[model samples]
Structure formats: structure tokens, C-alpha cells
Target: MSTNFCETATRVLDIEAKAITGLKTYINQDFNDACQLFFNTRGRVIVSGMGKSGHIGNKIAATLASTGTPAFFVHPGEASHGDLGMITQSDVVLALSNSGETEEILKLLPVLKRLGIAIIAMTGNPDSTLAKLADIHLCARVEQEACPLGLAPTASTTAALALGDAIAVALLEARGFSADDFALSHPGGSLGRRLLLRISDVMHDGSQIPLVDEQATISAALLEISRKGLGMTGVLNAQGQLAGIFTDGDLRRILDQRIDIHQTLIVSVMTRNCVTIRAEMLAAEALKIMEQKKINALMVVNAEKVPVGALNMHDLLRAGVL
Candidate 1:
């Protein structure tokens, strides 16, 4: 039984892979015109379809919206019942139908035409009504379905989805859509936190910062490190500028030298010219520096190199940037 199941799964995967690969031939001038139309559209790309095609359309619309092309799905069945009002003259309609003759989607063509809305049809049948009437037609043809019976929409839907992703990514590049722009659309996600979170937002500030004067003993710095629990402390000069940093590694080095922590001034044992970051830097940038330098903590400094804040790998982990 397991052998049969594995063989069937492999067959399905092969069929779907071929389906997606075959979609490359369809990426021609029609696809380019569709992408250009969607990119130049001043309003949203209204995506519509029926059944499984509707499901794929929803995902395509979401991908387009997140990737910088404003888009939303309008179910064809729902559009016939009142949702058609959601589309406007400024919008472009992207209709998906494997057979290219889904009754519900085709029914809206006349109205869409009256509204002066251009239609980009994604279908397996290039000669079908949806394709013939559309302003741009993209062929998402598949030789066979992944299903053994060849009745399911598996291969066709996969081809359509891959084509949609290709168009969205093409538009994303044409528009110069960046990771920062993508982050703005997904502010609640980890990517957004990594891109949008600044060092000042996550770093320990003011009283929370682990700090000691250069004149203070290493013992005092250790106490501050313990109190702040960042595994390190910033040592400040007489002018309150960041002079150096003392971390657990420094303590280990001093211990090897048999130096007395109680008598040693922090500046004498601390790592001077320590790598520091600005408060305005992204927390993700701080993580990169820490990883590259093989350090766990950093001192956030002002323009004058005065210590304003402090952060460690733990803080970045807590902030979801790690």
C-alpha cells in the first residue's frame, strides 16, 4: 500500500512540475502586455474567477497587492450578485478560468467592457470566448491533470498560479518594489519587524542601560553588567562619552592575567574603540554586525560617540530580529 501511495505521489508531482514548466512558453507578448497594463493601472487589479480558479485568483490578487501592484479578488459568482460594482473604469480585470468559458466570469465581460475596463484572461484554451474577447490573453495550458482521472484541476491550477506569480514578480521589478516596500505591507510580520525596527526602539535606554564611568572599578562594571543582564557594560569618559566597553570576555582575559577586579579601573581592562551602532540604525543591521564581529552586545551611541543605549543578541532575539 505504501509503495502504491508513494508511486502515485511521485506521478502527481511529476505531472504538476511539467505543467508549471510548460507555462514558460506562454510568457510571450500577451503576458508582457498584461503585466504592463496592470503596472500602469492607476487603480487596483480586480481579479475574478469561479471555483478552484477563484481560489487561485484570490492568492494571485494577494501576491500582487503585497508585491506593489494594488489588487484584490472579486468572486465572479459574487460579482454577478452585486460585487460587480467593486470594479471601475480605472481598474483592470484579471479573469482566471482553465476552460476559458466559466459562465459566471464570462457573464461580466459585457459590463466590464461598458465600464471601459480592460480584461487580462488566464486560461488553458487560447481560442475560448474569454481569451478571444480579452484585451490580453495568457495561456496556462497543461497537457494533463495531476489527478489520475484527469478530471481534477490540479495541473491547470498549478500552471495558472505559477503564471500569476511570474507576472506579479515581473511587475514588482518593473515598479522597483523593494523589501522595505514589502515590509510596509506586512508590518505585523517578522520581516517587517526586522526591516522597520530601529536600534533605539529595541535597545536599553537611559536608566535601563548598563553603564559605568572610566574611573569606576571593573568590579563596578561587573555589577552594572549583572544588574542590566546584557552580559556587558559601556564605560564612559569624564565627559560622559563612550570610552570603551567591558564584557564577560574581558573578565575572562583579566582572570587569566590574575588581575584584581576590585582595583582595576574599567578603562584599563575594557575593550576600547569597541564597535558601536547609531540609534537610527535598523535592529537587523545591528544583528548583522554582531554576527560578523562574533560579539553579543553593542553600545548605541550619539553623533558625538556618547553612549545613549545598549543592546545584546538576547534583545535582538526578543525583538524577533535574530
Candidate 2:
């Protein structure tokens, strides 16, 4: 028999998309109650399930943990042997069972209840035992499966996953979870670099900073710029405070002026009131200044306006803030 692959794929997508949309109707008072339970829980959220529901539960637990609610996944089958010790009286259990009658999850229900641990059940059958036993029953009911055989846990799992995300976001909002808090949890990511990396962390300080005396010649300034390799040098006053900055752009502007680099002092041609950044500011903020002012580098100064550090686009690029 001939089969249309694209048509079947399209039908599957349509079914799954509808399954996600169908979850909106299930966002009732039960959803709010579940969020309240998670928000108030001093201990972690323990997500337990069997089979494909187990995989979905694992992801749900991770989402909750990352978004501000503390959670982790535990296999219900394992809970019976010794894993039940992991669930404490302070924790809450989010059990996943599509039929609301998984033997493995149901087996742990008694222990969970005995410990006075709250059970939030996500199931397709509200009349099922798991649902009846739960303290909060979240209806993740789906109209049908995307599988043509109508036996697999396709649409049902999709609906449940969406509901889990909704619960996570609701709790995140309730806790006033901010982007900086998320970046802290996810420090290895690009967002973490952009948010957590400060100018002091990435800027070159001490002898690495290119500096020249205000009375120094252009040739001396160029030597400092090339030696430090930051494409610029801060012109410092006799008090060792920043006076102005000389960049490669200034070098180009003076090229045709017939002024001798050996004779012309740096202070004569340096850009006054040059853009600067503080060491405590975010590296991302430094990038914004560079982009807006159309410059490649910044001299990090202190409250005394002394140049303590130097950074360029290359520094930001290396720090993964660009």
C-alpha cells in the first residue's frame, strides 16, 4: 500500500499543535493551587513517573528547578526498593501517569501520603485512582494521540509537558524570578557571560594597560599602544590621572597633517573627554558604549579618574560578551 509521508507528518504536527492548545482549557484553579504548593514548599519538588511519563517528568523537574522552583526527578519503580528515602516530609511529589493508574507510581503513592508529602498528579483520567488520591489533580487531558494507531503517548505527553512549563512559569512569576537569577543558575551559557561578566573580570589591568604621559610625544604614545596591544593608550597627567586618550583613529587623522610624530606631543592630538567605563560595570554594558560611540576600546577608571584597566572589542569577544 502506498503511503504519503509528508501528509502523515503534517497531520501529526497538526494533532500535536492542537494538543498543546487544548492545554489552555486545563489551566484552572487546580493549576494555581499546584503553583502555590510549589511556591511555599521549603524543600525540593520530587517528580516521579513511569515509562514515557518518566522522561517527561524528568524534563519537567529540570524546568522547575531552573526557573526558581527547586525540583528533581525520581523513578517510581526505584522508589519502592530504596529510592523512597530520597523523598522527605518537607518535599512535594509531582507524579506523572497518563492513565492515572501506573502501578509503579501508584505503589509509591501510599508512602508519599504516609509521609504527609503533597501529591500533584498530572493525568488524562480525572476519575482514575491516582487523580482521586492526589492533593492537587492537574488535568492534562488530550483529545487524541498523534499516532495513527492511537496507542502511543504522543499528544498526551505533549499536553502534559506544556502544562509543566505553564506551572514553572507561573511559579517563576510568583517568585519574581529575574534574568540575572536565571543567568546565575545557568553560568556556563552565553546568557550567563553577558549578564554575570563584569568589566573587572575581563579588562586588562596593571602594567598591561597602555598608558602614556600627557607630555609624551605621539611616537611614545604609539609605542605604548603597540606594546599593550589594546589599539589605544590613555594620556595621563603628571599626577598619573587620565587626561585624554589617543587611538589608532587619531593616528590616521594626523597622518596627512605633516606633523612629526617625534615632535608633536600626544596631548596636542589626543581626543579629550574620551569615552570611559568603570571596572564594576557589566562587560555587556561596555559593549553598548563601544557600539554607540563607534569606538573599539575603553579605559577603565576609578573614582579618582585614574586609568586602572583597559579593554577593547577583542577583550569583550574573548569574554563572550560581544
Please give, for residues 68-107, the per-residue lDDT of candidate 2 as tens digits. 9999999988889999999899998999999999999999
Model 1, residue 240: C-alpha shift (Å): 4.1
Instruction: Please identify model 2 stretches exceeding 4 Å from their true place.
Output: 1-11, 176-197, 213-220, 235-246, 249-275, 281-295, 316-322
Best by lDDT: 2
**Could you tell me the lDDT of residue 39 within candidate 1?**
83
lDDT of 1 at 20: 92
Model 1, span 1-322: residue lDDT tens:
2368888889999999999999878778888888889988999999999999999999999999999999999989889999988988999999999999999998999999988999999999999999999999999999999987888899999999999999999999999998779888989878889989999899999899999999999889999989999999998898989989999988888898888889988888889999999999889999999999999999999999988899999999998986
- Candidate 2: the clashing residue pairs are none
Model 2, global lDDT: 0.93
Compare the candidates by TM-score and give the number of the best one: 1
RMSD of each: 2.6, 3.7
